[model samples]
Target: MDITCDFNTLPKNGHYKPLLEKEELKTQLLLNIRSCLSYLFPNGTFHGNEYRIGNLQGSKGKSLRVELTGNKAGLWNDFATGEGGDIIDLWAAAHRKDVKAEFHEVMASIGEWLGYYRQHKVNEAESTISWDYLDENGEAIVKVYRYDTALGKRYLPFDVKKSSYTAPEVRPLYNIPGIIKADKVIIVEGEKCAESLIKQGITATTAMSGANAPIDKTDWSPLKGKHIIIWPDNDEPGKQYAEKVAKKLIDLGVISLATVKIPQDKPIAWDAADCIQEGTNPLEFITNRKSPYHNNNSSNKLKKIDTSIWTNTAPERKWIIKDWLPVGSVTAVYGDGGVGKSLLAQQLMTAAAIGKSWLGIDIEQIKTYGVFCEDDEEELWRRQCTINAFYQLDMQSPAFLDNICLSSRVGENNLLMVFDNKGIGQLTPYFQELLADIELFQPKLVILDTAADLFGGNENDRSHVRQFIQNCCGHIAKTIKGAVLLCAHPSDSGIIRKTGTGGSTAWNNSVRSRWYLSKPDRADASDIDRVLCRKKSNYSASEQNQISFYWQNGAFVECNAHFNSERIVRNNYNKKLDLERGRRHDVILELIASEAYKGKVYTTAQFAKYFEGKLGLGSERSIRERISHLATIGHIKFFKRSPEHELSNTRSKYGYLCVEDMELKISEDQYVFIKPSCYLSATNGVLMPVENPNVWVTHNFIINDNFKLAE
Candidate 1:
């Protein structure tokens, strides 16, 4: 056997302590065997360096012979030697304390020595040094020994590789008189954390040296669900390193992970020694530390989003509300009147009824039966026919009709159509019922065609409308883990309005995504030639471009951009009103109050009725004129209906009032007239709802003189 790097490879007279003769021999023998076996059986099994020493073998027969294999091939010749041959000389040379040959070479060389004995008619004998050294196959098993240089004695195998194996050097620490069983396991970066924790009655272990130390796989198995608290250094790397280890514990099923954010201004705390020296109580820190997992759960609670509801007890992952549909979000799809918004909405509902993809968005289409409060069934069916013909979609596909739900075959929510369910109080129960059906369908998306029919009475009530939309969106997004695309009509001229139909900005305010469709110049060019502007978003990038869709007979096909108007409508109103630059900032509060009071009766007394406890203005006259000026700017509209005054049963209270144009106005009598509030301000005098405390006058115009107060 050729042993590698003996004492000769070390410095001759350095302070290095050389191995003893016996230890050297054992190390050489094992290294040679390992080196040879590793090369021969790279993938095949070979036990670790430790083994049991087996019996010595010698055979004497007429024609029996043995040869060397692997690295020991050059150790011996083909034939045995005797008498004049150099057999004795070579044997004496091979058995020297310093000489090393491969295990196979040594075996072959021994066989040659025996062959020499046979040629000379020497006697053969068999003896075993150890009883457990040989297997049934007569192969020699090696026994491993550790050299105790301190005592200069070889000890038996320690079985240190076991799960309970404590370092022999470090065992005395555990035997200390003051040692106590700690209620918590304090995991630290190094041995110092363990020592620091031990000082504080915490049983702890440093993950060896750093975060990357080797961990015993079996040792970690018992730690699952154990309370493991980690303290990282007050730096990015330390926090990241600690999180890495915590994740490993989590993967192995640890109870939870808590992080103690270290403030950077404090003295640097890299390891346990520093922490202890700085009087940092690692145990207390861990006990009081906020768990990242717990914080996440608590934050989710506020939005009524529960991740653990689906993660903890469920066999399969439960859908969280956030994953299904984000709270405070809106999603919309806009196209021309005849551009197939209804058809697409139906297809999406159908696809959601049977989990499938529409236009490449992965969604589980529920068995969605829409209520046709607006459209007739024939129109709906006609659209469906056109859709099927366009996409050549087979209705027989399992992805077509698994859990389909319908409210009305006419494609809408029927209850809302009849009852005008605009408030969350009224809509929640309805949505919950719909959600129950949606879950059965396991839909990933729902369709509410043209929001006008949905928020019937209070369509202009953005706050109320948004609350309802959020409830519906939240339920659908969470229960079925789906999305809701509410269809809405554009203004009469097809101009993009904040409120899609019924003109409530809240319609767009509550959706997560909003896609505005503009009329294509050439309708015949392609049904898909309309511009889709991503006017709002939370997840997707905000982009505006013309996306082409081709109405191939009846179905719409999305294609690569063939026509792009690349139009950017700068909302000057928004840009000018940004308070940061202070350009039109003075008007921000006015604009906000006007928007808040949108679509409501604005008589002086009614203003008090609407904003008594809310409007914090001192001068009522100024507030009224502010309303009048806002109306003049087209931000609001004032009306005087002939019989409008009696609608609220407060006849001629102010004789005329302002309301959002979209609001249905009822006239009571000829005396109760309905005209723009601007007409009242123009013909009679401005109605003052409040007064300004700090009034100013310019060279050209005086504040209170130019406009008189209305009676």
Candidate 2:
């Protein structure tokens, strides 16, 4: 840390300066001795930390060649007058207080300076708990926490004088020293939570910026492939922060992750600190047995699904260009790198923003947020203007321009991240604020340009794929109640296979809608060779699975083919998509749980037929596997119906309720007819069967044993 030139240091205004403890007084005085000299003598001159001229030696002019450079730095001599003294004597002499007769008084005045340092220490607003944000070696680069006084608790740094505290750089996480050694690392929101959890023998860490710092903004690379659980502050921002971190961590390829979303009933913004303050064990709150997200092949995990809470019908599919762009879902637009992913998305956004339809496809006329990692605002504007000119739309119209919000990272700060002020990985804070901005605008569509930049994860890793899909497409889209258009690259071979670049099959599987834009025979391509084919369309409401659009006049318009899927033999249905079956498995089980609680029963085929194309689930085998997968995951139990209510013995059904829901009374309706199998309820955390005749179970069926929020 470079020290600031202390040419204008100030002396303790005696009786007014707060007194600091001995060590603190020494440190404060040493911090800027030149400042103290300047304060003592309104007539002293300084060059750097040394004296340039002094009135004590009567060398008021810059004639002295004396420098203050001894171990005591206070010892200085003027070559012109050969006068020298310790720093204290110089201070006393400069004040001209008649030090010979009032030596004690002069000394007392200096002592008063030390006492000034103590002022704030005794002030009720000062907190005693000093938290250090340490590096891997346990050396603190910065210390920050809150001060307790009549001013209440205030978040502040250890001292602003140190560059460690005030430099506009992102510091490492608090308690980073222990993160590597701990088998399990729990990431919390603030320093206070980090401290509280550490005291309970739990290893925890958090970076600077509270909820504002994204996980990518810090040195998370240290914890790469480490199993960790993220516990967020019990608030909206905290939860959002957690979601962002979780996604990035997956990108980092962490071994496992489980999020302990503190129960909703707790106070808002409550954190580990609150739990510790209330004498509650913080670690006890972590709910799930840690497992890698998405591919946790754990044999006994039960997920409780409640479709009843979901809207009776999913939201109507919204389109910017009919089937090509669906609202309230994640759509993947992939093409050859530097092809037209960004251009296609931009044209669609411009059309949507201006209430104009693209390729004559009716649009919902909604706003769009375009996050372009590739181009700066100026570049985006240049392209926007070109398109605007081609469309002959008024670019000056605030109604037209304001309908589109463009956030470009270009110029000097193109890669310099303010969110990750230190620039470790600025994604978290960047996206966190970006999403908040989206919420404010509530745009119907958000175009994220290029996963190559947004996702720092290996495009091929399944875990990274799951995390990204769940967060960006799942959580972000749901939060804004809009659609997300993710622009990405396809592998060099993707032109032939029809999937996006490096991203795993999970990326293709998780999104509600997907498209692969490419050209036929790149070596001999003609103007009309480009094809924007729908690779996946779970948003089954889309009108077409594929379309061929010609790039003309700086925008896409109908060419030889449009508004048709059959024309492009290779379409969404034909594309071999490797979608993750786990998510859908949970959905199927949840729907069955909802029906079972209402005393409805169904076999594998029956359940499959009922929910084939609804709830974003698909395929008979995929649906059938939901039963075994739910039982394997432990959300529900697999059981056989008794002879009285016979379903095939080979096929088991889950009608069991989790004890957490705990509604066991045989109201004339709770169980219209008692199946012969006994029910297992997790009472007092012990799985026990009811011997009383009232509650009867036909046979063992999957039950949601781990039914609490994995939040």
Candidate 3:
């Protein structure tokens, strides 16, 4: 049976010591398994490592699911619940208790049970020895001992019986008095070596967890200012542990330190105890083999600045999509549904599949790959046909078709299995196979159609989001030396802040570039006009802020990039402005204000009658929309007169008001306009409402400089 290395591999020559011998720990911890069969599973049977405790709770009456397998090592595996670990881990899972909370109690119980069993075995027939660890005042702190059994060797406390096995929480030096008074101390790997060295009038000690324990786990202050010698085991782990311990000692302000490498031909774990038994003079060897400590590991040294390598000008960066996607980096393209995110990606892919310019940027027909989790192969193929028809090229020709590969139905495929739901990500074998297939293609740019479909985790969770990026997309991009464009949707995108994309900041922060695509309102243009706003760019010196495209010639063309749709609306409105319409709107508002000033209420029809033949709009739909637009701005208010009518009854008459005139109680509804603040010029040269008949407080906050608010 093989034993796990607790700290590092043990050394020879009586120079190294550790807490428990691996053989001993294995006998006590692994071989002598605790039998709780009758208690946990009534009328159940136990045979060797396989204990058939019937089926689990919900899975009762099925195959014997509640079976434990002592996996030869000091651990058990649960095939039913997919859990495996030490005895304590099994105990926690079996009883559905918090593992962390039950750790201390579990350890204590295991220790006690093992002690009892070891005592029983020893009483039958065994040989053992016990030693007492004393404090500085000569009081006994702990009793350490070892015993041999049929399984092998075991170690435990002397007072093991009905009382719980009390292990010291704060491990003191084996010989506290000798260690405190001695100016020069030798630190070994375990207690046995310390005890052996002490018997030879040498002050020596070892940490509680021996070489396995981290530096923070020990109270290293006791060794301060003492000249120390660390003698490690003659193995790989021992040498590494020696280096670590030396570093910790140096960090803890050791006055001086050195190490001794003992040459040995014995097998691993043959330590100081074996050396003494073999009659080797370890004290002489320690003196002869001592050498100054050298922390040769580069990781142990503080990071130093390297100013020798300098550049006078910025190095040129390779581009996948001229100011947007860069090679060997990550970029995100996000938008609301049907704003041409997929279509735009298809167009770009088509450009890369053939040697063509995209958005005026030329490409050399590099390899292109697309993974659309939301779309199936048929839909993706249809999109391919669209791309071919739009470009008027036989893209299905062997050359271009061979260069581009499109994968769909990804959610159905086993790809999502790679990115686990938990934050701790691990790539699966299936995923590696997929990556291998992608490697065969060697695509320069990979497009993840939608993040939500590709990532099988809570997008809102920062850990999960970062895990998906770092362990999935980021890993692929870095591994393949290519660019990755992740597609996502915004939360009420056009109306909400571009940063509010329904996830943690890591979604945006982790990517190097991001973009937003939105359709322009039909009132200002046609339904096919889309504005691609560059939301973020880290690599570009000058960002392509907004790229507008029309769905003309069957594809996205950058003939006229719309910088600001709201600004265009304003300019068009100004060019078509008529004094009659402005005067009529003013008169309607003034009339409402005049009536409200006299505490009199007016209706929409009454206001429309006054503006009849005085404005271009002829129907009530146009007239009401004007009033709603006015009310949408802070200029007017439309509501029901009282909450009593609204709260007590659904059937109630709605009212209107000129806000500055009187305290007209009302509630806002669809009748109220929802316009974003944009200004326009009136004959009076004061800023007036642009009256966008179709504006929401969306991407339209730019105010006109020539127009001031109505005082």
Query: How many backbone clashes can be found in candidate 3?
Result: 8
- List candidate 1 segments past 4 Å from native: 1-330, 334-337, 349-372, 375-379, 403-413, 416-424, 428-432, 491-501, 521-529, 559-711
Which candidate number maximizes TM-score?
Answer: 2
TM for candidate 1 is 0.34
Residue 137, candidate 2: C-alpha displacement in angstroms: 9.2
Cα displacement (Å) at residue 315, model 2: 5.6
Local distance difference test values of all predictions, in order: 0.42, 0.58, 0.58
Q: Where does model 2 exceed 4 Å of error?
A: 1-22, 30-35, 46-109, 113-178, 181-329, 337-340, 371-392, 407-442, 451-479, 496-507, 518-526, 541-543, 549-552, 559-711
For residues 1-711, could you state the per-residue lDDT of candidate 3 as single tens digits? 212222233444221123343223334544444454344345455565555543433233323433344334335444565656654455455566665765434444444455543333223355566666677777776666655656664456432222323344455555677778988888877777778877877788876545665556556667776677777766777778787877676555444566765565567865565667789776655543232223211111223455677578767788887778877778888888876789889788888888787766678788888877777877777777777877677855865778888877555754432233224444444444556677889988888888766676676555667666765676677666889888888755322433324454457667888887776433455777876767667888773466667776557776433544565666555523532344344445545644543344555555565556553556655565555545444345434343222322223133334433232223431112122223322233333443652332322332233232221
TM-scores for candidates 1 onward, in order: 0.34, 0.50, 0.41
| Model 1, total clashes | 70
Looking at candidate 1, what is the lDDT of residue 527? 39
Residue lDDT tens for model 2, 622-698: 55555444433334432444333444344333333231111122344333233223232433223333455334232
- How many clashes show up in model 2? 53
Better of 2 and 3 by TM-score: 2
Estimate, for each residue in 472-505, the C-alpha lDDT of model 1 and write its tens digit.
4544554545456677776542242222223455
